[model samples]
Target: MVDPAQILASIKTHPPSCLQATKCSSHYFSVLSGSAKHYMMFSEKICWIGFCLVGSLTHVFATRYESGVLELGIHSLVPGHSITVDDDFVICDVDIEVSFSHGYSSPGDLDVGITFDADSPVTTGLARNHSCGLFGPVHARFDDSSSNTLAVNSNTCVSDGSDVKPDGDLSLFNGHSSQGSWTLSFNPSRGYIQLQQWAVILTPCDDGAGTGDPHFKTWAGKWYDFHGACDLVFLSNPSFAHGTGLDIHIRTKARYQYSFIESAAVRIGEDILEVGEYGGYLVNGISNADLEKLDKYTVTHEKINSKQDVFTIELGAGKQIVVQSFKDLVSVKTVGASLEEYGGSMGLLGEFGSGKWLSRNGTVMSDAIAFGNEWQVLEVEPKLFQTNQFPQHPVQCTMPSTSNVGRRRLGESIAEASAEKVCGHWGDLKDQCVYDVMATGDLELAQAGAF
Candidate 1:
């Protein structure tokens, strides 16, 4: 009873979390057709490099598991100071550190051991056997991938290197479940060890979006198209990642019988960033230059060499909003954390994790037009625009009728086979690409659609 369209839409919208590793190399990697440089920032750790524009389109993607630090904040060495990592990442690597004040004895006297899932100590005698005979408060680190030379203090004892190995090498934990308790224990044989703090670094999670025309995809992987020419709330997540607030509003304009996103205004925390067609940008209704002085977010814009320009807004905690523009057409995308981690998010994007369309009143909508109209930005919401445009809040969404659809359709002149060939490998977006190409009579729209 499964629908093939829904299956393809899910796969096209939200590919499996790349942390699965196997699916990462075989699938989920996106290849953009251009020699021009393109960067796909998965997190601070992952990056994608674009290759040549001629012949074939190839992409070189390099990624590493993102790490998150959990503070232990213990003043003294306790038997079982631990933290739980509940994310679904594979436990590829682990590093434990302990900082202590200079007591009556040498820092080497403070012996430390760490265990995972109540198992044997991954490493022991971090400070006791290997402090490099250094004085002052010692910052000792025991890494799972260090040289396990415990007989005598090696030169590495002065650094992050470790003199002990886990019962099995750190690699043994690779592909193992990341959801477990990591316990840090110290020997009390040398009396109490005064410590400043202790902490562990573990891997984390990621998710986001990319949409254009009137075609939409929620952060939760739902896909649909709404040809509504009006301003609407694309996403409103007050609890977006680590308490960072985000509200994105998009304005769409009618083109023939179809519609395309014209502009987008994103409010992250106190600052507002607005991007529109033709590469113009505004921050809090001010000039784009003000984005450099943004307090909470890091903003960057690519050089505007072509018609379509890309801009990125970095919301702390590895979350970002990417805006792309191409002369009267614009698209918005999200990166880093998934919407599910935000507790709940609303607007035209629909429910956080449910693929069902949702109304602002919590009603499960049956169609895209109904769901999209419910999210129309109300006059009460903060107006991030410089000036009010026609058909503002209170006005119903201007739904475009498909009666004149044939006017934009591929006529008998351009065969369906020819249109498909010109659209290239757009995956599930090929149909939309073909339609946009015929509607505008511009082949470049196909590339812009990809952007």
Candidate 2:
């Protein structure tokens, strides 16, 4: 029921926020294709590496999204491209594109949905269907305008990882398919690593009824699926424990039924664009599927002509999968300044365990959500910061700074469009743990540098 396009559109034409995530996405440890959307760190990719968890902090621009409660901001995080956070639910905001494809296929034909589970674990989890993380697009073979030829009965979901292609049909387990090929491309703007693996018609032997030929199938039907996209970023070092772990078996276990992809990178000559942030975690998931291979390491790296290595797959029915597991201890944090006051009053800003609820300097404030449920940190408009134009911190004037000063409410209707806005309380502040949406249900209420 989630609309991936709506999510992407929000990122393309929406405002920014002043909220923060307290913890990484929750990790649903296991190995299987997922429904998309796990908590931030526990989202997906890192789940493939050891514990894909980051320690100390999980720094985002510090924004939160809620239905009628808050708006998710999508900015030109990358040049030439705009991105949005998918907030079909709590936590995650993986990027996704719709009615979009690799000129070969699309995923819109399938009932795929993107979700936001900002908090997942680094270890075990369940299979995800029609969900997104970081950057995503549910791929299926129901060709719209993009596909020029009818290739086969298959799904072609794609996203961030641009250059996609299966190594080949031959591997350690099942024999290679006689039909179907792979493709690739890149969408640097959305942090998308576009990849497309193409094949046509089911090769099922029908209980060994006859030789499997995609051209003429007897009992099975032909499906032309397209929309393979999005990238699953794996840690540079999987052996080294970090973030949440992903079980690869579930992916290959189902074989042909699904495809599990690891991380990929984009290189404009020498500059490398990592799909996910430098230090993010992957949520736990089942790599459950029939994969003739598992490719690890720099699927795409600085090396221009470097060919990726796909892992071996062992398939067939009644095959129990023993997967590689992981856990995420990764944490993200935001960088900010503090807000001193005109009075140079008692220290400004509150202190949390490792984070701060207080403003950093004369015009800056910071907020964090800790490691559980989401909490909004209201950020006032920069125009509000203009009030801070007062040559000092806590500006306490018997008179309002100016008529414009009143427009600086963190959650004010006028202030929701700026990049650097205020959130939460400013200077001297006190609050309680929040279990529900704010009275206004608007994230702007959490603005910084406010009294």
Candidate 3:
């Protein structure tokens, strides 16, 4: 049972910034030209998958995975970002069917599919045996991802998946390639059988171009939409979709169709009931308790004052100030005149305040004190997001850019925020402590995010 929410989170942490990364969903959504409705419709591919049936999830990941946190402020994953998840339609195991249309609406150009090397694995890129197959240079014939011969007349075959080479006598052909053969091979060990793997063929026949449609390179790489696998074909249909911002906003039961895309309905033993109809957008069988704490995190910072009170601090690349009020306290005041008044260092409010203040090297705090009675202090410092960059905001408003011109043009004041996370060997501890404490232990705000 694949977890839909987890899949989204994984995608969010690494939101395909470059063309190569965006190849999966980006190239996948290439809608064919609207005018080519007559001549030739692209060949539809179909895949048959069972059990691994994950129900539709109503969410997508908040960020794309990256080695480090992005310097740019990340968008949140709240409501209004909902996608759809479908229910089971099968009896025993779950099946999936996905189809593709013309390749038009490209947010940007891509540089992949130009070659088929493991160097730039597109999509999830996790498929183990994704190497030269079906007709690249490493096969019994010429096996390489860059050969355009197959785009013409070609065909080939495979026998096994053993991590072994083909009969050495003909394994590496320098000039020979095919129209279709083993274009792709997962594991060379699993012997080839008609029922085992899906064989896709891409035959090129120019149908001509459309008036205003955009041009995109045919993704020479292979990707799978759950179970919707078939004799995948890239219909050089001539016409393609045309758009800068490609967003398909649909609701429940919004049926989508494509050719050759094999779709199968599936039902798990219990939890996962259906898949294939809608994109896996939601994760079923999750308890309300777990779901509540499933996402979201809290952060704690040391008070730069001496009296105990809640403080509002904005953490990010630019322009944000969140207010967090301490329980049972009202009168809030600033501890330092210029951020250097209270020992010039940051420590927590309650527990962190008790520690003795020490200055740099051998220096010590003469009258330095931690904690304070300040609850309304905004942390938009001047040195945030690099000492010279900033954004303007006026308190309320979610989508700032999506706001009215008046609100946006209010004034261009510099807003700065830098959130520092607590560090330690045990990563989970930092996550737990910050999340629990910032809950404010308030029942009314049980739903209010700690951030």
Against the correct fold, how does model 3 do in TM-score?
0.15
lDDT of all predictions, in order shown?
Answer: 0.57, 0.20, 0.19
Model 1: worst 10 consecutive residues (lDDT sum):
47-56
Worst 10 residues of 2 by lDDT: 207-216
Candidate 2: Cα lDDT at 25: 29
* Residue range 1-451, candidate 1, lDDT tens digits: 3343454466567665544422211111122233111111111111122111110112222233336632212233344545555544433245455554333343334455556672333434344443333243455555555665443323223433223443334433332445566555655334333333455554322233435566787643456788888888888888765666778888888765778888888887787888987779888777666566444667888846567788887766666678888766788877754433343677776655443467877887787777777888888888877778778878877777777677656443455676688898788779877766665555666666455
TM-score of 2: 0.15
Whole-structure CA lDDT of model 1: 0.57
Indicate whether candidate 1 or candidate 2 has the larger lDDT: 1
* lDDT score of residue 14 within candidate 3: 60
Best by lDDT: 1
The TM-scores, one per candidate, come to 0.53, 0.15, 0.15
**Scored by Cα lDDT, where does model 2 land?**
0.20
